[model samples]
Each structure stands twice: as C-alpha cells, then as structure tokens.
Target chain A: MNEATIQVQKLTKRFGDFTAVNNISFEVSTGEVFGFLGANGAGKTTAIRMLCGLSKPTSGWGRVAGFDITREPEMIKKNIGYMSQKFSLYDDLKVWENIRLFAGIYGVPHHTIATKTDEMLQRLGFASEKNSLVKSLPMGWKQKLAFSVAIFHKPKIVFLDEPTGGVDPLTRRQFWELIYEAATQGITVFVTTHYMDEAEYCNRVSIMVDGRIDAIGTPKQLKQQFESESIDEVFRKLARRATRKEV
Target chain B: MLVFLIEKEFKQIIRHSFIPKLLIVFPVMVMLVFPWAATMEIKNISINITDLDHSTLSKKLVQKISASNYFRLTGLSSSHADAIEEIEFGNADILLEIKSGFEKQLIREGATNVSISSNAVNGAKGGLGAAYLSGILQEYTMEQLAILGIKPVPVIKTTESYLFNPMLNYKIFIIPAIITMLLTMLCGFLPALNIVGEKEAGTMEQINVTPVPKFSFILAKLIPYWIIGVIALSLCFALANLFYGLTPSGSISTIYIFAAIFLLVVSGLGLIISNYSSTLQQAMFVMFFFMMIMILISGLFTPVSSMPKWAQLITMINPLKYFIQVMRAVYLKGSGMGELTVQMVALIFFAVGANIWAVISYRKTTH
Candidate 1:
C-alpha cells in the first residue's frame, strides 16, 4: 500500500554462459525491513549488486531511491548506504575519524559532522572510546560501529550484505535493534542473510532458489503456505528444490 | 570530500609502525652508504714488475708506477715468468716487464719497446690499470729525453681538463641518481600497494559504494604520496649536504619542477598497477617486476649508451632514465630548463600518459 522504495521487473545478470540472477522481480516500501534469503550461490549477492548499482544487469529494469539502476547509478549511490560482509571500517583510524570520513564522503554537512559524530558515539555508549582506534574495539562493537557509520550520512536506504555475519546471537539481536531504529526513522532496510531466525525479524521475506524467487511473503504467511510450523521449515522446504549447490 | 580521503590516507601512513620510520631511515641509509659502495671508479690495481734490464731507468719506472695512486707495486721479480705467475695466482692484476738494455737502447736508438701485460678478467680494472701504467711510462720517456738533451722531432702535447666534475668524484654523479631512486621507490611502490591493500582489507568495496567521484578517489590516493615524495627529496638533499658536502649546481627550483612531473609519472604507474591487481601479493609482485626492469634499464648503475641497441630503445620509454638525466644535469652540470627541455618534455609526456591511463583503468563498478 505504501510507496515502493525499490522496484524491479525481470532484472537479470548473466556471466558468459551462466545466468547469475534470472528474471527476479521484487518491491519493498519505504521503512520496511526486507529480508532477501538464499543459499550461498543462489544469486542473492548478484541481484543485490545490480539493485545497488554496483553491477549492471544484463536485461530488464530496476529502480532504487527514485533513480533508474541503469542510467542513474551515481544518483542511486548518493541516496544509499552500504555495509558489506567484511569489516569496512579503517582499523588504524580512530572511531570518530572513521565516522567523520564516511560523513564527509556521504556529503553530510561539514559543520554538523562533529555534533553528529559525538551524538552517535554517545548513543552507542562509545563516547569514551571515540578516540580509540577501530582495530582496538571488540568484534561485536566493530560491527555495530560499521553499521552506524554506514548510516551516518542518513541515506534513504541502507543495504546490509550479511551485516551481522560471524557475530554471536546476542550481539546480532542488538544489531537488529539498531536496524529497527533506522526503519522507524523512515530508512528502508534491504538485507541479505544466512540465518533463518534473522529472516523472521523482517516485515516480509523473499526465498530465492537457483537464481529465482521461489516464494515471497510475510513470515507467518510463508509458514502457513508451506504448511510448516516455523519460518525455518518454510526456508528449508523452498531451499530443497534448489538445483545449484553452494559455491 | 577529497580532503577526507587524503586525511584518511595520511593517517594510515603515519600510524603504520614501520612506514613512517622507513620513510626517514630508508633515505638516510641509502644516501649514507650507497654512494661509497656504488662507485665505478677503479683504484689500487696490483702490479708485479720484472726488471730484466736492472738499469737506473728501469728501476725508476718501477718506483714511479708504485708511487702513483692507481697501481701498487706488489713485488719485483728477476724474470717475466715469475711476474706472470703472480698474475695467474690472482695476487696481481698487471705485470710490467722492462726488457734488457732499456736505458742503453733509449739513448742509442732513441726508442725501445717495453712490454705490459694485464689479466683482463675484470675488464674495467685491468684495462684502466694498463692505461695508467702507459701514461706513467710516457712521462718517464719525455723526461729522459729532456735530461739527456737528445732533441727529437716536434712532439704534439695534449692537456686534458675535466668539466662539471673536475676531480671526477663519483659521488657527485651517483648521489643525484640515488635521490631519483628514492623518489621512485617511495612514490612508486606505496601507491601501487595502497589500493590493493584496501581491496585485501575489503574497504575498497565500501568506498566504491559511496558517491565519491572516481577522480577524487584517485587524486586522494596520489596527493599524499606526492607530498611524501617531496619531503623525501628534501631529506635526501639535506643529508647529501651534511654527509657529502654536496649541493645541486643548478637552480633547486628546476629540480623540483622536473621532480614534480616525475613523481606523477611513477605514482600514476603505481596506480595503474594497483587498478589491475586484485590482491596485495599480486600487486607487489607486479610492481617488483616492473621496478627491477625499470631501475636496471634506466641507466642507474650503468651508462645507457653502453647497452645494446634494442635495450637502449627500451630506455626511451623508461621514465626513470629521463628523470635520472634531469637529476644528474641539474645536480652536477648546473643545467636549467633550457638545457633539459627534451627530458622535461619526456617526463611530462609520461606523467600525462601514465596518470590518464591510471584514471581510465580504475573501475568504480564491477563488470
């Protein structure tokens, strides 16, 4: 019912003879936490790369943040924030410096950078560690800081590619709390992840198998449609039909 | 935004435990040690003399050769065979044999042949040693004729004077080239490693996702190294002054102008290497491969004129060769922009060509 922040129609990407992402279509309204679920090589990353304007699609069309993916990649870049699976923060840089660097890159107003950095550090209870090098922080704190820095410029949409990967469950829950906070502030969250439980936290989830979206619905609806007791069962049932193994 | 990128680069460079120290120590060690070690000037050639004549003139020749700095008279033998044996044992580099009746023949016939043989295994040392001995012999003959009052036909005399480096100090020639080497390594390898380091760390992926312009990103990567290169050059000049009492003969500004263009060329080359390589190891090997070829063929240690025609042609494209010429000319010959226009144009061409290639090859998005 709400306005779609992302729109796709028959978006596909092919490499040589193999089609990486095949005719996948999806839409997510503003402020919704959309979970993109798939196996390792089911083309989730390839599709996300195309949507994020990082890779050109071989065919079809997609739009993000009111810009065509093919023609307006730079505009899409300006309106989006991305946190990759790998730790993105400069380890040698101080926490505040990392925040400032990203803020400056994202074209956050220069004057507000200091105030915003201080506010974010205080909110994360990282005020005392503001001057500490990012490498000195624990892994969980680094992930949280990376996520916060990703959205520091306050882009309309933030794409998290396995943002909570390799972290403990409790830290992951806290990370999600931050995601929820961003969503409440009207930022669309497009996230891909491996954990089934994490998928349940999404407002709606898409299950991709063999480069195609096999199912898409709310968690409860997917569970009922698959005749399963949990979203995990719904995922396993859809994932079983995958012809391509994890790469 | 560019400021932020450059600031991040400087912070990383300064924070690295080894890089900052290496920046200072590397130049100092290279300037302090390499000049003395890299000298091509031949000295202290060992000579065994066989005085078969045993005449005063023959004995005087042996003393003259020994007293001269170039040759050390290792021993005097009764026979030429003994002296040749010394050369075979490698104890002596050359053997001078004054034949029988050296002074009698010179006075009676006004001419006599003296034999000189040298082990030419080390061609430069051997050849130079023999030439120096002959010069001493000619001086002795001219003096003998003057003393004996035996007037011969008019003799053509030639007086040689060395320009630029009158004393022919090897350091004056090499120190400038060393400075060029320092800039090449500092500006060349660091930037080559920088972007690939980010790729290895996965930060490049994060930077790519931002709205940062590609040119801004590349400029940010290069500007810090350019500044570092200038600083390293200053340090080299300072050390050369302190240790070797050497200063550039020409205007310092001319050197800086060429150095500025040369830095862009090398850093651009580095960026091009970085753009193509996906891993740090890949980048380092590729850089090392290029650096070895460039530094060697650039005429850093040897003269480019001496190389084979094909190898000499390769130096035409070598940016280091042009910069080395500029440095040597400005530092030793007091040459200015007027004298170095060809090299200046070559450097500018490389600077533009390399940097444009670097920027074009750098892809912000994956294909």
Candidate 2:
C-alpha cells in the first residue's frame, strides 16, 4: 500500500464547551482525490483546517505529509499547499506577480519559476491573461488559476476549501480537470465542497455530520449502500440522522 | 522569501498608476496647506480696556499694552459690563479694568493695582495672552520705579538666547512636528489598514498557510513603509528648504538614524493595532483614536510644560512625543546623539517593545 500523505487519528477540536470537530480519523494516500462533504456547520472546514496546519486540534495526533501537525506545523506548511474558499489572488496584483509571490514563498527554485509559470499558464489557456490584474479576470478563471498556483511548487498534498463555491458549472468542470491533472501527477488532493455532484467525482468521499464522520467510502459504494440513486440523496440521509440524534 | 513578500506589498501600494503619484504628491500638499491651516503662532489677540481712572496714567498703560505685537486694542468700552459683553460676544479675548482711584493710589503709595480678565475657554490662547500681558506689565512697572528714582535692580531681568531657532520661528518648530505626523499617517496608518485589509480580502488566510515566518511577514509589511517614510521625510526636508527656506541644523544622518528607530515605534504600533482588529474599518478607527491622543499630547501645538502633571505623565508613553522632540532637537538645535540620548533610548525601547508585542500578539492559526 502507498504511504499515507495525510493521517489523522482521534483528532478533536473543542472551543470551550462546544466540540467543533469531535474525534474523527481519516487517511489519504498520495495521488488521491478525497472529497470532504458536509452541511455548513458540519465541521468539514474544521477538519480540513487541522490537516492544513492552519488550525490546531484540541487533543489528537495528526500528520500531514509525514510531519506532526502540532509539533512541526512549519514543516507541514512547507510540504503542503492550500487554497481558501475566499479567493486568494490579490486583485491589485497582476496574474504573473501573484504566481511569483507564492512560488517564492513555497521555496520554488528561482531559475524555474518563469518556465513553470509559462508552461502552467499555457497549458490552462491562461497565457494571454498573465499580465492582467486578477480583478479583471472572471470569478471562474480566477478560481481555476488559484488552483494551479496552489500546486505550483509540487507539494505532496494540496488542500482546497470550497475552491469552486461560487463558480459556474462549465468553469467548475474545467477546474476539476486541473484537479485530476494534479492527482495524476501524484499530488494528494483534499477538497471540501457543498456540491454533491462534485463529491461523486472524488475517488473517495467522507460525509461529516455534526463534527463526526457519518460515513466514508467511494461515491458508488456509499450510494448503493444507502439504496440511493445519487450522492445527494446519501448526503440528505446522513444529515437527517444527525438531526434525529440531536432530537 | 522575505524579499518576495516586500516586493508584493510594494507592488500593491504602487498598484494603480495614480497611487505612486499620490504618495509623492502627498507631502507637497501637506507642506502648502499645513503651514497656513495649522500653526502654533499666536497673533492678533483682541483686547478691550475700560478705564474709569480717566487719568493720563491709565491711558499710558493702555498705550503700552497696544504697542506689543501680541495684543490689538480692538475696543474701548465706557463701562466694565460693556467690556465684559465684548468678551462674551467673542469680539475681545481680554478685558482690562482700571479703577477710578488707580492714578491717586499710584502717586500716593507708589503702587497701584489693576485687574485683567481673559477668556479661558481656549485655555492655551488665554494662558499665552496672560503671560504676554504680564511681560509687558513688568516692563511698565519697572518704568514707574525708574521714574520714582527706585531703579535699584528691583526688576528681575531675563537674558534670553533662543536655541536652534534664533528668532523663535514658529515654522521651524511646527515643520518637524508636521513631518512627524505625516510619517505616522504613512508608516502608522497605512500599514495598520493594509494588514487588516489583507484579512478582509481573504489573502491573509493564504499567507497563514504558507511557511512564511511571522517576523519575515511583519518585516515585509514594514519594509515598504520604512522606505517610503525615509523618502517622504527627506522630501519634506527638501520641501521645507524649498518652500519655507528651512534646513536641518544638525547631521542629516542623525535625523535618519532616529527616524529609522521611530518608524519602527510607529509602524509596530500600527501592526499591534492590526493584530487586534478584525476589519480594516476597525483598524482605521483604532489608529485614529490613538493618533489623535498621541498628537494632541505630543507637545506639537502646545508646550509639554503647560499641560497638567497627569497629562504630562501620559506623554511619556506617547511615541510621537519622543520623535517630535528628537526631530526638533536635531533639526533646529543641531543636537547630536549625546544631547539626544534620553529620547533616543526611550524611542528604541518603544520600537523594540511595540514590535515584540505586535509579533507575539499575532496568531498563525486561523480561528
């Protein structure tokens, strides 16, 4: 079996009396598209944040790209890439400038930045938009480019937090192609999303309900096990179970 | 890695074609407007005299008051009530009362008493007016003593030699204060707003997830402001020379050395504010609140000696106070590092403390 790029065991994050993420475990091997799906308050973001070194877990052990999340966050940060739900590109900055900044931040070789940027932009059909300010680009194209910048340094794992939240369908489909391309290049992809249709595209999906992983499986396996025709129906069933448990 | 961040920040600051232009044009506008609009020089104080003495002595006293540059005899009232009314209507800043028997008492006892009423609503103006009036009256009293053949060194003489500004030029005093304020606005306000601006724009989250060291992140934000602040101060000095015919009397390197430390004091303060505030608007208001308090108490417009003891004690922590003092000392007095050791040490403490506080207060983890 491939070594796990991301591994969390009994990871719990509690804010005072409220448990934000309650004792969940998951693992993603290299080059896997893992979808993290949940309702707005279901702690998908909380879990992803713990893995990305942006938030600390309350009491658990987690490792990202073989670095301890609690003890060596700096090492984890160096080995992974992250894209936020909120667009990360600076509107005032030109496209090329933003790429250069992150490339430098990720410790990419100086001699290769220009070539890598040119090749990536050319491949994404963004060659013509390199000099334009990010604000001038459409939302879809911005998110697509943001995804490319996230992995520009070839981190072992990349975490995307709702990367296509407000994107259009066609652009989102185009963005998924980039995700697949990265996955094929042996980069582990951890993504959280609201779109159930997007979850089916993942090699494996974890549905979180009220800070606990209600189910984790391949999309086809979960749909068939739940006797549901689609991933959306399976999500609704788990959501109903969470509310019933609350009652 | 740090250089890239600074380059990004500089790019953002000069992002639009108009921004760099505006940054360069700002000090010139301030130079033209601030000299005229905001000045500590007091002149044209309105005075009303009501003389019931009806004596040549009373008239002579009035002439003496009017001859001074600080006072203008704007009204001569027939009654004390009328003179009080002039003050109430804001037409007069001071009222002089000469008693009916003022000349008889002066001749008989060789001493006389007169009363003066000052509008104290503007405490600074009123206090200065009173002081000027006392100076003039002291001279007049000595003259009376001379006439009485009692010129036996009865008056305490003050031999005055003004330093830095030989003529006590208000511009010389105020120009450095204005430059300090402009630097605060640039280094202090802009960086405060920029940090929170990133939080609002969601770019902070991206930066947070990177391996960017906190110190490097802070220094990167600070570098552009530091560079711009130095340029602005030098340009303001040049403008001070060009427009106001003023130049630093001390070593320019001394001023820059102090300024480099002072910039950290202010910009670090701004960063500390940014770390506390979640929004750019909140950061702005917080910076405004602190800047107002700092500038008002920094002895910019008023002498620090004039404020109440409690207020004076508070000035010790106001970073602008030390900078203003150091700037004026170096610019006007040609004061070297030795004469400025106390202020320099205080500013250095502030710079170190504020930056440590800023970095320590900052959290790498997202909420």
Candidate 3:
C-alpha cells in the first residue's frame, strides 16, 4: 500500500486535568479529502491543531509527509499549510501584499511567487480584487482567497479549520471547489466543518463526539450504517450516543 | 444636565480596568520611579587614590576623601600614571594624588597643595568632585591657622569661577534627563499599542500561522518606531542646542551612538510588553507601568545618592540612570567614548536582555 500522507497512532491531547482529544487513530491516503466533523468545542479544532504542528498532543504520535511531528516540527511546518476558522487575514494590508508576505514566509522562490500569485488570483477570479484591502472583501470571497493562499506554497498537506465557518452556502460551495482542486493536484486536504451537508463532499469523514471519535466512514456508508438517509441524522445519532456515555 | 452627562461618561470610563490604572496607578508609579532614577549625582564615584607617602596625615587625608559622599575609593594604585589609566579605562572617576612629606609642610610652610585630578568627562560631576576636594583643603587650612593664632600667610586671597552652567541650574541639567525619559515613552509605548491593536483585531494570530520568522515579524513592527525614536532624539537634541544652548561638547557620533543604544533598549521593552499582553488596553497598561517606573527611577528629579541605600541599588539596574549619565557626559562634559563606555555597556545589556526576553515570551502559536 502507498504510504499515508498523514498517519496518526492513538493521538490524544490533554489540557491540564481536561482531555481535549482522546486516544484516536486515523490515516489519510495521499491526495484525499478528509473531513473532521464535530460541533463547537468537540475537539475538532484541537485535533486539527495537532495535525498542523501548532499544538502538541499529550500522548500518541503523528507523522505528516513522513516527518515525525515531535522530532521535526519545522519540517512538518514546511510541508503543510494551515488556514484558521478566524477568517485569518491581515485586514490592514492589500490582498496582493498579503499574498506576497505569505509566499515569502513559506520560502517560495521569489520569481515563482510573483508568477504564481498572478496565476492563483486569475484562477480564483480575484484578479480585479488584488489591490483591494482584505477587510473590504466580502466574507465569502475572503475565506475562499484565504484558503487559496494557505496552499500557495504547494504543500504535501493542507489543514483547513472551519475554512467556511461564517460564509453563505454559495461561497462555501465555491470554497469546497477550491479544496477539491487542491486535492486533485495530489495535495491531501484535511478540513473541519460544522456543516453536515459539507461532509458529503469529503472522501471520508470522522465525527468527533466530545474528545473521542464516535464514528468514522465514507459519508454514504456512515449514513447507511446508522439507518439514516442524511449525514445530519447520522451526526445526531452519534451525538446522542456521546451524551448518553457522559451520563 | 452637563453634570449628569459627565457622570455617565465617568461611569463608562471607570468600568474599564485600564483607565484607572493608566490615570491613577501609573502616574504614582512613574512619580516613584522618577525620583529614584533622575539623578546625575556621582554616588559611589569610584576613585583610585595614589598616596606616595604612608604618613599619618596622608592616611587621614585618604580617610577624609573616601568618607565623603562624592567618591568611593575603588582601588589603591602604585603610581600616579596608573591612577590616570584607571580614569581612562573607566574603572575610576577621580584620582587623588598625595605628595610625600605633606604633613611636615603644612605646619612649617603653612600652605600645602594637594593635587586632585578628576575624570571630568562628565564635566559637572568631575568639577563637583574637584570642588569638594578643594573645599576640604581650604577648611583644613583655616583650622590650622586658628590653632596657630595666625591669619592668611602673605595675605593671599582665593577666588572661584565657573564658565558654562554657572548657576548650575538643575532645570537645564534635567532637560537631557527629560529627553531620555520621553524616549522610553515614545519607543516603548507606541509600538506596544500597535502590537496590541493587531492582537485585538485578531490579525496577530493570522500572521503567526504564516511561515514568517518571528524575529523578522518583530523587526518589521519595531522599524517604524526605531525611526521615530531617532527623529525624536534629533528634535530633542535640536531643542537642547537651540533653547538651552546645550550642544554636546563631545563627538556628535558618540551622542548618536548612545541614543541608538538607548532606543534599542526601549524598543525591546515595548516588544516584551506587547508579547505578554493579550489586548491593546492591556498593552497600554503594561507600557504605562514601565513608563512611570523607568522615568521615576531614572534619577531625573532626585539625586540617586540621596535615596535610601536600597533605592540606590535599584537605580544601578535602571537603564535610564546610565543613559542620563551618558547624555550629560557627552553634551555637557564633551566626553569621549572612552569616558562613557561603562554606561554604554549597561545600555547594551538592557537592549540584549530585553530582546531575548521578548523573543522567548512571544508564543509561536495561533491556538
């Protein structure tokens, strides 16, 4: 079998007395769309952070792009890109400047950065908006642009933590198109979302209930296994199981 | 109706934690640190005494000089040249040269001269130290005349004179000190506020997730302020030259170099405060706290020598104390780099230490 782009072994994270991620293991094949499904405060963000090398897990080990996370964080950071749920973009800077800065930071070759920026903007249909301030852009377009910039360095893996959180359905769909394009280019895309409908777009999805993964499978398979016609119904069924376990 | 509006505004202001701390707590802290820091008095002015003769009178003279508050005897040099080198190397501030057979001449010749060479790179303090030594000699001469039932031998009269800063007006002396104090505010406060603003807008987190080296990020933030600090220092220098006619008598390069070091230290302080604070308001509070403490403890208003011993020790660590000393030495004394090395070293320490602390404290995470 081909090596997994991301490999996790019993990944767990604890914050003092509280565990944010329990012992859970998962692997993503190269160039696949992997959805991290959870509600607010359900450890989706925490798990994504561990995968991106932003936060260290309390126990368990993970490798991204074949680099040990604990031993070579810089190597991991160099190979993966992250876009946060916070609509994270420099508001005071022009979109072009923001693109330039991110590209420079990722150590992209200067000549490539210049040409690639033009190409990316054209591809996103944001060429006319290049000179506009990031704050002036619509929320949807901003999120879409932010996601494109995240993978500007052409990383082996990209983690999007609620990349479409506050955007409308139209923008969210357009953003997923961008994510799919990246995945098709042989870049693995790991994303977290609250939208169950969005889960259907992923090749596989994992539902994190509390700190543990309550269910994981292809969207259609999970739906059929739960005897539900919709991914939302399956999420509800898993969420109910989580609350009952708490009792 | 106006009072009602004012009272409502007051309530809104009071509701926020930073306002009270900035207005009340910070000023008091500044006042406390200012008096502690604002002095140019050379307390513990390390001096090396060269006593050729180990006479009882020479011992008495050494004891008297060391006993005074102006100078601390740091070393006993074997030769007068060694004493001079001590001043040159910055290990000593004043050199007391005692000639041999000094006691026998005082009774027989009735007039004895003791050479007091002070490191006058800080023109005022060096002059003060010299004047103090002369005053002690004149008093001793007076006592001897009274004991011998005689008056001034050959009816000789003494006169004293001062060229610049004749009045020794503290207000003028304090101009440089005030300039140094304001730098900490300008360099440390404004940049700190900008950093907090980024945090408040959530832009800092956005930048953090990028692959930009943290030091480069810090430098880009500090560059604008470092330029502003230089401009501010130039303005202050112009004012000092125009209004007070206080052109630094020393090399202009020395003064600028010292100012650069001082600005770097303040910038580091601002970065550290910015890194630790989560919001603009918190950053402002933190900057306000440091501003007050730095200015007050800078020995701007009070002589550090006059402070309690513990306060004296604290002033030694305050970067403002060294900057003030260096400023006065360069501008007033026309001191060369040789004379101001110790203070420069101290400022360098502050710059490096503060920058290291800021970088270490700056978290490299978006979480």
lDDT against the true structure, each candidate: 0.91, 0.88, 0.78
The candidate maximizing DockQ is: 1
**Which residues of candidate 2, in runs, are more than 4 Å off?**
A244-247, B16-22, B36-41, B53-69, B98-115, B127-159, B304-314
Ordered from best to worst lDDT, the candidate numbers read: 1, 2, 3
Question: Across residues B164-262, which tens digit of lDDT does each residue of candidate 1 receive?
Answer: 999989999899989999899989999999999898898888888898998899999999889989999999999999999999999999999999999
Candidates 1 onward: DockQ, in order: 0.78, 0.71, 0.16
lDDT of 3 by residue, B1-367 (tens): 2222233223333444564355443333443454346556556777788888777767877887788777788998878889989999999878888787777877677777678898888888788877777877676677766776666666466776765567765545776677777677767886677666767776666555555566666666655567667777777666566655666777878878988888888888888888888888888887888788777777776778888998888888888889888877776778889988899889999988887787777776533
**lDDT winner:** 1
Instruction: Report the C-alpha displacement of residue B67, candidate 3, in angstroms.
Output: 43
Among residues 3 or more apart in sequence or in different chains, the pairs in candidate 1 whose N, CA or C atoms overlap within 3 Å are none
Show where candidate 1 strays beyond 4 Å. B51-56, B74-89, B100-104, B144-154, B305-312
Q: Tell me the alpha-carbon RMSD of every candidate.
A: 2.3, 3.3, 14.9
TM-score of chain A of each: 0.98, 0.96, 0.95
What's the TM for chain B in candidate 2?
A: 0.83
Q: On a 0 to 1 TM-score scale, where does candidate 3 land against the true structure? A: 0.72
